[model samples]
Target: MLDRKTFAEININNYIHNINFIKNKTKTEVIPVLKADAYGHGATQLAKVVENIGIKLIAVAFLGEGINIKKNGVNIETLVFNYATPKSIKENIDGYIYTIGSLEQLTELINFFGKNIKKIKFHLNINTGMNRMGIDIYNLDKIISLIKEYNINIHGAYSHFATADNLDDFIKEQYNNFISAIKYIEDSNINIPVKHICNSAASLFFPEYSLDYVRPGIATYGMQPSDIKIEKELKPVLTWKSTVARVGLLKKGESVSYGRTYFAKETIPTATIPVGYADGYFRQLSNKGYVLIQGKRCNIIGRVCMDQFVVETTQLNNVKLGEEVILIGKQKDNIISAENLASLAGTINYDITSKITKRVPRIYIEEE
Candidate 1:
């Protein structure tokens, strides 16, 4: 079936199980990171699914993303973790929540809603070491004064870690910085309501980073953050699969695909899959990857092409056209983990999960 390969199977029940498990693990509030379309698991679908389970706050990266989530008719509080642009003030001020990291932006925000209900809740992101966003602590007092003068509702104080996924010292440094800022905000009489610094990495390995709340993104999808030893159980909730398009035998010395990247030593069997990099499957996987088919390892024997890739199934017999192929996920008696694919691509689990393009269809399977 032309529609079979290149589709992602999303286990909705698995995702729900993950959220419940995370809730049990820590006392902190859960903020599921739904940005980048829930790491390409389909944002609107995920938002609706998680909403039923009662996530108080859902996060997106930009104004349009928040708008899209809101437009979906799910009534959860949406947080824009990324900065809001000046042009988007109407949208931001009207309904969307904003995070202010720069004094100039804060000034703009105050001016936009001058003399209005200035108690609009907002978050202040402090830049401890991420070198990304946030006002330095030196200007914290000045900003606090501005916030008070404008009567802005200081809802939360937050920051991002530079290396929470790594070893102890780096996370400690960021944690100290975050806690110090939290103290500064709380001690300033601002009545800040929430303080959070944990991303996926921090949520799992660094408990100290879990302040009033912590946001877990990739880890909730059942992928480990930073290869650290994890005591908690996790399972990948997504899998990619396709059907074999064709199968043929290659004679000895016969080359396969562009550049003749791989040549068979003996007569071997091969299967062609109808998915390629255009489907968000990385092209670099040519001759450098493997997939599970019929519960056995199928090796890519040549350069991956534009719309299809070939895998040699020499060890196994009777692989035929239209047989199910698993690019990611478990098959009978075997599995080719997403981590293995990420390792082959020189990236991490986050990239692998997020890179699956929108063009590919997703099927939500209710896990039993």
Candidate 2:
């Protein structure tokens, strides 16, 4: 066993299960997004697992991540969705598919490839309504002309949905706009092979727009994108656990942790957990977050330190050193889920998992 007070238990079985579940739901090809190190579940490891299940296409945020996946021996079609700087572009984007949205990116690729380019493929990102990335739909004429002008080997075309998880009216508007863009491509007779737009929530809720491919991120990790309801059983795949470093008796009126933010009204029991903001446990959870100690919920006390935090255990008897502390996972009849922590930290569930720093070791678990 690795000697560490904090570690993440990654359920490999559930990870595969979530992938199969997505494939079943879409009834089409599924491109699992492994950006942010598979949302901090270890991207390379997850890529191997994904490839084992016959998934050919994988998506990452940038070129470095795609290269890392390839370097780690994941021989599959990897797509880089985010923009790349002019300096970052190289002659050899081998074993990778790149996305180009703006004219600048297209020009950069054209300049790099020049006349005699071989087998490099790219996707055209159409900005339907996200307004974050992708070419503006209104500028489709220029985008098409540029693709043909440079004789770019376009493999796919896609757009990201702005509000697929919520706002039904916006979903309809964005879908229509995306369809209009695709119609333009068809009318122009541009035969792009792959076309996708639905994200995790979209794939779950909107089967009609699954298109040629569906990219699922958070749902691939078995977590709902938002509090919005989706009728599917996605097993929780991550369990953040730590050990009680020390147990102590607190005197009446004695404060705990930094800033003396928490004080005892009377003599109380407390346990120090060896996890804090440095480990991606948000400091905002100070005096607000709760953890499971001996199968019961305990309130966090005082300001969460950079490396340690204290939890009030006066409600429990015989709280001892080395007792299990569930930071984000089920413990007996109780649980502290990523969604719970995200709500407390005023962020999304993806932030909760993706921000888990590399300092903490991930222990992969696969049960029979």
Candidate 3:
């Protein structure tokens, strides 16, 4: 029984299924991206799950995230994707595999570690065409020179795909650039054992680029990365739910919520759910969203409040307090997915799930 009025249910089985699917598809090392708290599915918990499943490596966006995984007794290799600062490198030397994208960042690591720089290992981020935080292909010579000069240990090399999901011509361009960069490093006598550049989209849509390691972020959470659908099987791992808080009647012409945007055209029964924008339920869903109640879709009646929102419950056979209300999940024959919310909110699926605030507790379950 759930004590919290609003919470997210995480199906561990579904998560594992997604991971296994990606692994089987790629036929290579699968590095699950746990950044943004595993796309708001709870990183620490999922990291432990990954470790238990025999996966050797996981990736995060910050030093603190990687450190948190280490602190939780998860021994999997936590690779920090962001560039490391002097303080971060010194504070937790062994907790993370830092990503060195620029010559200056690499220089900082060498300066901080000094003669012991060889003891530290990092992945080189090559900027093919994203022009994001990475060592430009033109500057790879300088980066390679510095690594040789200090005898720095290079554990891996990687790049990001800006258009892998779109299947554009530029993906080939970036792939070719990454290939040339790796060859240049090897020709200079630097051995980077692990090489990867495919994200969730590329991992699914362009498996050839999976390389030695595939970093899947959104796909691991069982959400489609884009509109380009694939034949692979992926199930949603999270179900955001709430309970009917109050049942009441709104007279004709009665307004609901703060903005008074919804005025009832006819007298109708209404149910208020204990969820709102404060709980990561977007206010943009006001008057446009629907929730599953008693196996039926109930239209949101007005502007979503800070802690509660009204939904027209006339479609239900009967409405009662404390009844199950699904914000994102299957309810009987109907379902409310994050992608559904994202579409109604004028955003992508990533924004919908990742923005779910920390106020709501996550309950992990292993469904058969």
Candidate 4:
């Protein structure tokens, strides 16, 4: 008996199902990424739901996120993928894992924790090809030296691919770089605890990239790089819905909404919904979006303003005030997937979930 609002409904069971799908896919282990607040589905709630589902590690993008989850009282090994401040690193080491990408950063960790550090877990990130984080491949020896000099526990050896999510020549080069770095590390006998490089796309489609454990982000929340076929069912955890605040009839040649972006050539009916870009519905969807209503798909009739938008429903009958509008989930006869929204905005699915504004209320639901 959870009372969900009209803005966002989180299907927790679907989220859990998606995680179990990935977990079973690996005969080995799975590290689910709960970063970006569980892809903006509320990290604390998601963590609690999946805590007992055999996830050995939970990862976040920043120090604050890790801390936030810690505050939630879930006791899984938390990893902050991005670099943290000295203060934040100490906090991460206090109860979670932090990433070590460079000797300079390693020195910062040592200075912050002092010799009091003991059995602190961290990943050694290799720049491989992304050149975004991690030590460069050429600095392998330096990184190894720092690993011991600082008494830092090597939890994992990780890297990021420049194009793992897309089909490109660069992926091959990045793969070579990743393999070379791993070989180099093994040759040095460092033997870091875990080895991983797969993002959601690579984990799902590129089996070759799955190493010790996959660091999957989007797919854990039922989203992949783009729309790709998967044998395992991935359930989308979040669904957006808002009530129709008002209903109206527009005569022929009547323009709807703020910018007059849509005009009706024939008399039609329109409904105003109290959701827009301010709620992370994406203003780009204005005059260009469709929502499922009464088991039928309806078009947006005007520009998506900050707090509201209009939908044309003349073709459909029996529409009324206070009816539910499906914005990001399957309705009776339609579906608006994260991939579907991302395609319209020329963005990634990750951005689509992360962009959801906090103003909207999130309600959690599980299988009855």
Best by the TM-score measure: 3
lDDT of 1 by residue, 50-74 (tens): 8888888888888688788878887
Query: What would the per-residue lDDT of candidate 4 be over residues 242-359, giving only the tens digit for each residue?
Result: 7777888889998988878788999988888888788788888887788888878888878999888899997778788888889888888678888888888788777888888888
Prediction RMSDs, each to the true structure: 1.8, 1.5, 1.3, 2.3
On lDDT, the leading prediction is: 3
> Against the correct fold, how does model 2 do in TM-score?
0.96
Angstrom error at residue 45, model 1: 0.7
Judged by whole-model lDDT over C-alpha atoms, candidate 4 comes out at 0.78
Please write out the lDDT profile of model 3 over residues 1-368, one tens digit for every residue: 35647899999999999999998899998999999888989998999898899989999999888888788888888888997677777777774688898988877777777878787778989999999789987878888888888888899999999988787889999999999989989999999999999999899888988899999999988898767675359899999999999999999999999979989999999999998888899999999999999889999988988888999988777788899899999999998888899999999888999998999899999994
Evaluated at residue 139, the lDDT of candidate 4 is 75
Clashes of each: 1, 0, 0, 1
State, as a TM-score between 0 and 1, how close model 3 is to the true structure: 0.97
For candidate 3, give the lDDT of residue 280. 93
Question: Over all chains combined, what TM-score does candidate 4 have?
Answer: 0.93
lDDT of 3 at 147: 86
